[model samples]
Target: MSAGWIYNFPFEININLKAIDDAVRAFSVKYEAFFKVITKSLGGLVNSINFVLNKIPWFVLILLVFIVIWRTSNKISKGIIFSSLLFLVGVAGLWNLMNETLSIIIASVVISLLFGFPIGILISTSNRLNKAVRPILDTMQTMPVFVYLIPALLFFGLGKPPAVIATTIYAIVPIIRLTNHGIRQINAEVVEASLAFGSTKLQSLIKVQIPQALPTIMTGVNQTLMMAMAMVVTTSMIGATGLGMEVLIGVNRIEIGRGLVSGSAVVIMAVILDRATQGLVQRSEVKTDGQ
Candidate 1:
């Protein structure tokens, strides 16, 4: 009759997640040397990108962006509007911070493509590997983004390296999943016909499978880029410097204006990237269809 008996009829079990954490920590420490090399390499890459971005004259970079937008979209008005939005970030005094954010994103997306595309190809060729990797990708995508920061911090420590590591982990899934999906979605008959016509496995994959899958793969790239951008603010928690850091500072200091402006800059950049990438994807699909 007691409320406890009626409402709390349950058993308690505890999982030793701390033990897993401890194991990871121990492993990280045990292989600290290797990790340091990776950390240093990644830091260098981010710095190189940041330096290049920062060195570009503001007007020149804006013009480049306008050109890209114009070419991809085939719309002069959209190019003008997007370029103006980018210029507004400079007007708001966040251009340098935006560049820093772009540095991190470019580095992360580059690394993601380097690893994800090949793994995706391998997995697509083998059902067993696909089955094995599918659940792992699910875990990665479903796992809280915050959890990625932990391993990243342990492996690479603070600043751009860890930021890149965490962002890459979060963003890479889409490309891998989509690459495999895209390739697998190809017609088996098409692949077989290529083989029958003296196309080597490598040739078929390179020419037929990849070209056909390009649109889907490009979609994955767009998603990966977006996810990397989404991580910018989160990575700021670990000392990443960028528009994200500005937002964090504003939040901590309760400066509504600062946070709002920085957040808006981030949005503007994201919108430009998303639209441009989608336009390219559509163009690729049209080209592929026409072929």
Candidate 2:
């Protein structure tokens, strides 16, 4: 025994890996069309993001983001801080790579929200679904990220599509879990009162439950974005392009400076994104508390 155990008489545990491979292969062939559809959608998004990021000059992109940040924040200081972070990204001489990384993260988060939000709503409404999905989400969250790439590669082949799909899968759990938690946490008394007042189920959900849950959901969104960013970088092993590639190359070559700089850039982006979304969470909390 590999473990050098004394229980050698237990019979050979020969699990046929070939059967699993054949099953997956057959499944992929049957669902090839569906896979292609997903591929086109994700590919188009990646292409669009890459094109715009490439076309836009660094200064203009930074300035535009700064303007939006300033307007949203209602504070020049916040905008300046975000802009400075952008400048750091630019100065790393890896703007294009960073842009590629950002594009994947954005695409993954958008996809996560599109799917996770509705599923979360469904889970919140149905106890059976909540029980069924909780274990799935827990497993997804607990599994090593590297494990995701295997099936992702099988489905999407390689490059950006697999990366995006893998990223969306890995990052989506927080949004679904937190959104469910948030909605479920809403006071039962409040829901009962809303229903008693002749509000339809849909109306109560739209007007009360969702509004009350927005802050917690946004917290989920924040976490999802962070996880997406982290995974997008990690997905470079399967042909993803971005800061992850830089880090990967550094690792392969044992170039300490290259890896550190690329890693630091990822950190800076994470911090900025975290802070911006944090502001949203704070505002949402304040509104909820005020009411």
Candidate 3:
């Protein structure tokens, strides 16, 4: 080959590729250890919660959700929603699967909130950090959901932990972006007024900025919950059992009835969650504006 040809650059490219692979291998080892420790700790807490919920009668759980919805929204909507969920569960004949799906959704949301909110707050306070993180969040949001499954499988190896990890990544971007946007959009006059009143930065953030921004933040949370539900269903391809497994099995085995039932189950679950979370956001907005 001519020395001037692109193929003549093989030796240099080979060294670069090897270096990149070595770095990736090192990161994988560290990531695996970190993932294991965190998942184990959280897995215990999830199992404890699941055990408690399992002991409750399904009817009771449904009733509790109804009461929560009514308290947060209103009675009429709650009644309609409760009936719809009940009908869906009965028709799908997958009450247990629904519960399991609910459990995973709950766990993922809780974890996302716990981690996401603080990160959001931090990013909101620092413009430099926000600029740095914006591109990363964009990448996370735009990347194929299936691509997440590959690294998730490598790190956590195909189970609820991997499922939760993927769901969390897929669902977390909204909250961070919204929280940053909400805080940044706070009126300059309001912040100045707080400072004039001798409020500390922390005090201003908590008492003034956060209260005003609550609606936007809540909207972000609503979106996150919906995305989590969708991603969790997709995670079924990797052995995380739920409605997703039913759908996956149906597709693989060419069982039309199975696919329809499971797909409907997912749709029902999505609708219920979407309405509930959006209701919460609307209520929050009303209250914020009212105040």
Candidate 4:
């Protein structure tokens, strides 16, 4: 009465997953030089944040951030709200975790911009490259984010580096896509006019394209930041410490109060970052108005 034969494979596949894993481990060991370069880059970024956190008193850092956000936002109320939320994280006793989360976001965004912008520019220049890369970017954007952690852990090992490597991969697509779109969307007439002035390609790009694309680029950055935070809690599975870990521990212990408070602090951070970046985009538009 049970037809199990229809559902099962006809033969045993005998795939050696353990061997595959060992091969990957051997590869990482064999290429330590290549690995070290990336490790240093990731380490430097995370370490710089710890350096700042160690040197600055928490209250002083809050004041400084308030001043910068207030001035950049061009709104005192927005600054006050941001500062108050930052303080609330401390009151919630998640200040250290918040710092870890913030550092991770900043580091991932930095690396995203570092690689993504140049690759975007390269793609924008060639229809062939654009055609080839678009599908890859789509895959990177759509893949289950958790899938990144396996290779990330294999190559970078755990703790901050793999967490960052995973996050950077997860968050990088938006910047590349948006930057390429922004550059390509510029008026053909403007580009032609710049060349008519006998400008070299690099000159035209630096003087015209990037300035015009600033708003869109900033928007990509904002999206990347949000995406990075979205992954923070999940990345904690691989030795990351932050608001993510706080939530993880809370869940394991059935501590709903802890989970809610830590999660809310993350939301507050997201809002402040979102609003601040939006202000930058608006300002960029104003600057580009006449051009």
Root-mean-square deviation of Cα positions for candidate 4 versus the true structure, in angstroms: 2.9
Which stretches of candidate 3 lie above 4 Å from their native place? 1-33, 70-78
Best by lDDT: 1
The alpha-carbon root-mean-square deviation between model 2 and the true structure, to one decimal in Å, is 2.8
lDDT of 3 by residue, 1-291 (tens): 466667565554335867765776677787877878876865666566666767888777667667666766677686567656766675668877776676777788888888888789899989899999999999999999998887677767766777888888988888888887888898999989998999999999999988888888998899889889888568897777878888889999999999888788888778777767878888888988885
CA RMSD for every model? 1.8, 2.8, 3.8, 2.9
Q: How well is each residue in 71-158 modelled by candidate 4, as lDDT tens digits?
A: 8888888788899998998898888888888888888888888999999888999999999999999998899988888878778877
TM-score of each: 0.95, 0.91, 0.86, 0.89
Residue 82 accuracy (lDDT) in model 2: 87
Q: Which residue pairs collide in model 4, if any?
A: none
Candidates 1 and 3 compared: the better one by TM-score is: 1
> Please, what are the lDDT tens digits per residue for candidate 2 over residues 106-171?
889999999999899999999999999999999988899898887778878888889999899899
C-alpha lDDT of residue 68 in model 4: 70
CA error at residue 167 for candidate 1, angstroms: 0.6
Candidate order, lDDT descending: 1, 2, 4, 3
**Which candidate leads the pack in TM-score?**
1
Clashes of each: 0, 0, 0, 0
